[model samples]
Target: MAELQEFIDDRPDAREVRKALAVKLVYQGYKYEEIQTILDVSLGSITSWKQAYEEDGISGLRLNHKGKKSYLTAQQREEVLSWLQTKECWELGELEYKLAFEYDVTYESKRSYYDLFDAAGISWKKTTSLNPKADEDAVAAKKKEIETLLARHRQEIEEGKLRVLLLDECHLMWGDLSGYVWGKTDQEIAVRVVNIRDKQTYYGAVDYLEGSLLLKAYNAGNSENTIDYLRYLLDQSPQSKITSFFGDGASYHRSHLVQNFLGEVNQDLSQEEWKIHCVRFAPNCPSQNPIEDIWLQAKTWVRRFCALIPSFSHLKWMFEWFIRHTTFDFATLQMYGAFSEIKY
Candidate 1:
């Protein structure tokens, strides 16, 4: 059942109506003791009346005091209500401006304004949805799993002659976007994008632990592209020296083309000197792979400088900017939701 308001003596004549006299006495600039002395009222009576005056506004001052100077004239209240009517959101600072300009009176301070506001019962509020359940336990489990995987992988890296690399991809937009911004306002600083439709995207390959860029390209990250990139690196190097590569579970990375390419590399290379291996990322767990971390760094670099690039002709080349000038030489990579590396 819904709650109903309790009975109140809202009529012009009642205990509350009588209480208004003391309220008016106090509001008219009489101190509690002065009101008590002049009106033959007790100090407690003065206190209750003042409380009601502050809480209920003008109606609370209708106690029929014969003659009392008004602390705040009737006009002052109308002005406050008028100001409130014109604005959608209220800031006390804005109200202070009017007080100082019209009356040459400054609210003592923020504390003073708030103290008065409490009795007025004007509370600030925000809108939010009450979400049910939490995933703290699931998150903790993921953290533990990633930590364990990284430890095991590091041990394999040191114990065996396995060259471990992480693979991933990133989508790069052509121009400025306000999905991120500075300062707190819903207003967006419009930024122009080069090509709003076809935008752009990039694929990357990197060392899992060591900060190194194995390969990069601005193209569809399919199995063919992955194979082609590995072949390009093999052609550039003195020998196809990379042994083990770890990649997130993208369809292209998991396709037969990439598998065949790795198998062929293993067959062609000297068995004693080199052999290629692959590590598939666990389902829905891109953070388990180190390249995911590298991709985030790549995005940070692109976001900060993408506007400087002269034309879309070299949009894909922006990622290499991070490789050359980013503070990655002695970077430490962290594994959690996704692999991430930071210089600090």
Candidate 2:
């Protein structure tokens, strides 16, 4: 029933829509004879359509003129596949146009075009951006440093005397809630955004040993908020004697105000015995911090239910709720050689 509704809303060809509507009516307890009378189709056609849909799903309802036989010869198919591989990207209509104009052959079903794409080793994928300024050597050195640091404190961490936290900040905006979703191709899909620039700052830390998460929201990620967030981390782990934070080299993280706060907290202890410690990842290499992935997952969680989020406040609440409630066991967390370098 849901498939039928999606197909109907997508506004495919009139014939396919008619078949899907007929099937939907049948599922809604309409008799085959009633469906025939309403849709002006024969009883046999309605029964066959219903049977085909049950057996093959949406693909069953697809129209094929050659009765399940290939429309293009094997040689022609090879030519099409070769032509498709010549481009990095394509649209469905381009393939259709190519077949129609060059070979005078056209398949009524879009699946045929997709099948051709599959045969040519093409699949739909999202592109990711690369940081041009990231230094490979610096990232490797930082990873090694973090591994050694974690190894030095492995005994304390195992005994629950020390807590390791990977920290990062997320600047979420109303525009961030907008992402890819399946919808009607003929109609424009839009999220109602009162102000795209309206933003919220979030500080998140994921426990390296326990997989627990700590999240806090603030007006901005300045020195003041950074200090408070550090205090919040300390407050959460009162039983632990030491808390170590690994994060990016944001200016506020190393600001004098934040440094002064840390100094006050560990004034009586030596550097090794300080209650709180902070380490910076290599510059411009966010991939080194697993907390970056946590932030991304939180935003993705909120975006999945963006339709139900009534306002920016609600969006922020939903984002925080997911982070605080979920236990993160990301594979990237193990990429820093913690498991091999540090004995549990």
Candidate 3:
């Protein structure tokens, strides 16, 4: 029944689509009032549609047309399809205004407006903001460079001379927990979150060669936190001939303090055989970092039991549990497409 409602909500075939949807709801034990409210049809219409469906199956419903024909003609529909093909962003209210003023057509409701968009094979969805600074060609070149460097590092790892680690920071707040879960289609499933600005920022690093994760929670990310993390890593693996760590182009990663900590010559910028090396990932490119995958898995696990997580301390405990219990595979992480996509 939920699936049927989704189908009905998504397309604008005809008025009969609503009747068909009503019939399904009726069969699913929905009261006429509920059906009328959901489908935006009168009780009389709902009764007639149900009777028509019961008397003659789908054929009876098809015979009943509730109103005049759609305002969008065949040519206009073709125009809409072409516009959709252009992949331009549109607001529903803007489209509604365009329909009313430009085409002299008005939909009965927002539902009907969306139905027309669905008919045009368009959908409303959540979107991520794209970085305007990102360049495809530069990203491709950087990806190739990273892959070549990784291949060389892999050879060093085999010789027990180098260890490669990917690092990133995650803001762990009460609102961070959200994902699809089993719930009634007509209602929303709410996750509890605190109103206070209380959160923890975790600086996390994963050794792709050993599949071991190092994590530290902080109030915020800065040069101090980044340098502190690098110092911790240096102490953890002091004997390694070379420890190369990859991170995003955050200011802290390139700060003078961090550079000095890594033993780099800040003035001349010459390469030195330091025990630890800091490598910055390409700007606006996160797919290259596998630590993101680890955080995703951990956050997913935390969201699964969102009801049980009541406090910040409990959230930290859950993070600890996930990290200790989960056995992240090294070979799988190394072969992740973020690395393979660059290989020619």
Candidate 4:
């Protein structure tokens, strides 16, 4: 110990050698906390040094062994972290390519590349689906239109004379329902599953004002099913309230048949009688509909126990159960800030 201290004091620049000397002291029965005072090093550093010596003797304590130099400095890596958070999605290889071209730092191996990502606290994740083709100008126009309609219906909404309905569709499959679950590291989560390719489609609507629900299952969603759904809603609704249908730009909603039905219904009704109207949401914008959030909640609720669900019939039952059970709090849904007012 005396000789090691003398050597360290005589050669203060030999950091790696000093680290090895500290580990040797630990091997000679010195506690890490005790060694921290003598070596003028943190207990954490002392512990790591001891672990390295245990794993690979003195070689593990060697510095300048993080392999090839990183292209990015510490500060630059923090900048990269900030930049990554701002992106909607990215691939690791693409990011690596960008780093190479932008910072002139190329990694020699996949391990080193991943090490940098780990240090930056970035993880590979499933990308969220968003419509890249949505027109920004059209979205702005739709937003303004929605605002105008809300203002126009403000008095009706306050008086509860107008019913605001949001409509959408969803699909349920027989396999893994929605999200990831805990499992063995390398082994996939397995289940005794059947009908992996089969799916059931459903058309659903919610009256945000009255919290009423309408759900129907179908083989697929198309113009015919949409028309049938509208007929069902019109038949089920009260004969005195003005019902407004809000939906996305699915062809069925705007088809000549639907438009003709709506026009006929409006023509037959007096100004004070039951009536229907339609408003198309912006192109490629599902967020404009509050019912989309309800679908997500219903799926998440039922799919959490998907592995235990016995059959397709049972799954369908569970799906309907969650949909029926889900609380339709208009204020909470409106708070999502998709639309400033629910009048339209």
Which candidate number maximizes TM-score? Answer: 2
**Which digits, one per residue and each the tens of the lDDT, describe model 4 over residues 169-203?**
78877663645567788697765457776689998
Ranking by TM-score: 2, 4, 3, 1
**lDDT tens readout by residue for model 3, 93-200:** 566555655665555445766776787777888887677777777777766776777676655655555667778998777676666788898899877776535678
Off by over 4 Å in 1: 1-161, 175-188, 236-240, 268-274, 306-310, 327-344
Candidate 2 per-residue C-alpha lDDT over 228-253 given as tens digits, one digit per residue, 9 for 90 to 100: 89999999989876555556668988
lDDT of each structure?
A: 0.53, 0.79, 0.69, 0.67
TM-score of 4: 0.65
Compute each candidate's TM-score over C-alphas: 0.47, 0.66, 0.64, 0.65
Count clashing residue pairs per candidate.
5, 0, 0, 0
Cα-based RMSD of candidate 4: 11.6
Candidate 2, run of 10 with poorest lDDT: 62-71
Winning candidate number (lDDT): 2
Rank order (by lDDT, best first): 2, 3, 4, 1
Q: CA RMSD for every model?
A: 16.8, 11.8, 10.2, 11.6
